[model samples]
Target chain A: MATVAVENYLKHVLLLSEGGEELVSMGDLAGALAVVPGTATAMVKALADEGLLEHQPRLGVRLTTRGRRIALNVLRKHRLVETFLVETLKMDWSKVHAEAEQLEHAVSDEVLDRLDALLGHPRQDPHGDPIPNRAGKIDSQVYATLATCATGRRLRIVRVTEQSEEFLRFAEDSGLRPGAELSVGERNLVSGLVTLTRTDGGKIALGVAAAGKILVEPRG
Target chain B: MATVAVENYLKHVLLLSEGGEELVSMGDLAGALAVVPGTATAMVKALADEGLLEHQPRLGVRLTTRGRRIALNVLRKHRLVETFLVETLKMDWSKVHAEAEQLEHAVSDEVLDRLDALLGHPRQDPHGDPIPNRAGKIDSQVYATLATCATGRRLRIVRVTEQSEEFLRFAEDSGLRPGAELSVGERNLVSGLVTLTRTDGGKIALGVAAAGKILVEPRG
Candidate 1:
């Protein structure tokens, strides 16, 4: 029964705090939401009052268990919607995120379950992000950022950081979809650019920032 | 950029208007949204100010072309989500409507188109409600209420008017689905009950109210 804005805030806080034992800072939330610090403070206080979040002035923000559940539910809905949009609708990978972002908050548990079944219960979304199970458990897949892949190493794209649309479009055009294989050809230490040869025989250069956003697993 | 509540109003107006010939009353809107007449009036005025609707005093209200477009978009999103939830996630039919209702307002065109493609450009939802096309056009399929069907006529269930979970469960339990075949075995003039024989050789009795909600087509 959470409002859309409230759900969005919970999702952001959960994503920011993933795999970390730290509280998200007010400035961080503000920057993420692109809101003024004062606005973010007001919203955060509202969320805390709703029992979805905990706020400590100097310590930043952490989700209560209830908050985390809601966050995971939203994430599950988003990823499932993305997968449905791409696999069933044949939508361009670049276009599904925004649509899924809107849909993730609205679907019911019954719809979510049916979509999961229809997609054959995919472990990862189109972006290679894990889909949380019914019990809210995320699969712990070990992945390395493209920036850390050694030169000459063969790797398979596993996931990409959900950042800007531009980043997603670049990944799509460069054949960086999940399960695509690439061989690291060279690395520029100064610029953090990495040249890679894709399994489809395509070649591309990725800057450190871009490479860092791409998660990969070493290929045998 | 319409809010969920606003989108709901638009959709309700569009559906209630049914071919844009009649103006929808505030009483009708209130009944649809389960709100008070004053609340409906306030909302209708707000929508009028936004230019999504036209109010004709005692004649009630109607959608402007722009309003129709918005309603279609919301409908497209709703049907697509229902299709996705049922086809992909394996959700029960009864559970998808409420979820899709919320999602219809939030999903973008990109996601909607993708979902349409993923669902193989379905023309109808699970309940046999026609999905609007991309141009905001809905196919007008004629249906006869089961209560009015001639006795001894073979027919097929095409759609149901009630979207409630209890109603859906009852329909399902009675072997009534979109394509289920039935014969009007008997009709009681006094009690207004209809007895139907299912293709699977089962007999079920439907009250006049329930029969009125079911739309059926003659079997070829």
Candidate 2:
């Protein structure tokens, strides 16, 4: 049985390796986990010894097939728990992340299956993050950050990279969510702030750094 | 911040001292937590120093007011999570215990409040355990073990004491649930087995040990 700390590291690495192309370095893992590079290196080695990770010194760390399965499972649990917390518990989206972080490691498959049934097997969580299916497969979306979108183009918010609570609250207050259509109204070359008009007839301003983390696609 | 282990111990002791009763012994704490006596002693002392517990050598430990509040909050979280796991997640009641055990300590007040709202402020969990309210107040129930009931009396199952998977499966197969009405037909003194007839016209055999752990009340 893997410890919760080990499971968290594996999940973090797998999440960072989205698109199946990127390799996660020790520094990246440490940054993601808020730990020291040396700590990340030691943890990576431990995971490698447990046959859950493949590490090439000076390169990056990748998950083994077994490790990937566990990581996906953890992701699935996290998303499902978040959905449950929001839809059923009436929990604020910002508050559910921390609770789900701990619960993802503790819940059983039986509970996950039950939760999936109750939530009608949602494909995405409140934040637009994909929920992995039972087969450990995720529905990947082709999206670009709002900062990269051309001005005057209409795009639908698909997902936002979850980072800080302040960022999530800002997004929520800005009328952003999965499936929300928006038109880029203006862009500031100096400040990189993007002004957007939502389909709901609301206008909001987003800082360049915040807009850069939001994934969107052209609206049909 | 209380460690998970310490929180668990405090919760256990608080639960054992229901109705603002007296202190709990180290041996009792150890038994409840499945730890050794020496370990329980060390933990009790630590908790006492933290002002979460009042320890008397050779006597018992009691929760401080602050400790009681924390314990009740943990209970509230656990019950809410279990309800979410079963009602939303479709988790088996038996399988939810261990998962809820870990999640209870990690969930925040915000999450708990939201979950409670989602569950419509449920009074009891999947296993018929009562949930504590926001003020750390729990509603008391007047119910007795099925083993003590007189034969030929009609009663409805109120709760099950054991949360093991096997026990839940047996209860499900036997048509036992929170509102399942049954008539006790006969009791085998030698084998300690009770023969019950379900309202749905099914005959079931329950071991005396199991029956003794199941709480029920007279049917209306």
Each model's fraction of native contacts: 0.96, 0.92
Model 1: per-residue Cα lDDT over B116-205, one tens digit each: 876789999998888999998898777898889887988989988778999999998888889999998999979988999998789999
Off by over 4 Å in 1: A139-144, A180-203, B87-90, B118-120, B198-202
* Residue clash pairs of candidate 2: A88-B118, A89-B114, A89-B115, A114-B89, A114-B90, A115-B89, A115-B90
DockQ comparisons of all candidates to the true complex: 0.62, 0.64
| Model no. 2, DockQ | 0.64
The ten-residue window of minimal lDDT in model 1 chain A covers A13-22
Sequence-dependent TM-score of model 1 = 0.88
lDDT of each: 0.84, 0.85
TM-scores for all predictions? 0.88, 0.88
Residues A1-220, candidate 1: write the lDDT tens digits: 8978888888889888874558999888888877889988898898889888899986799998898889899999999988987787677777778877767876777677777888899998988889998899998666788888777878988898864677788887888878889988888989777898987778899788778888888887
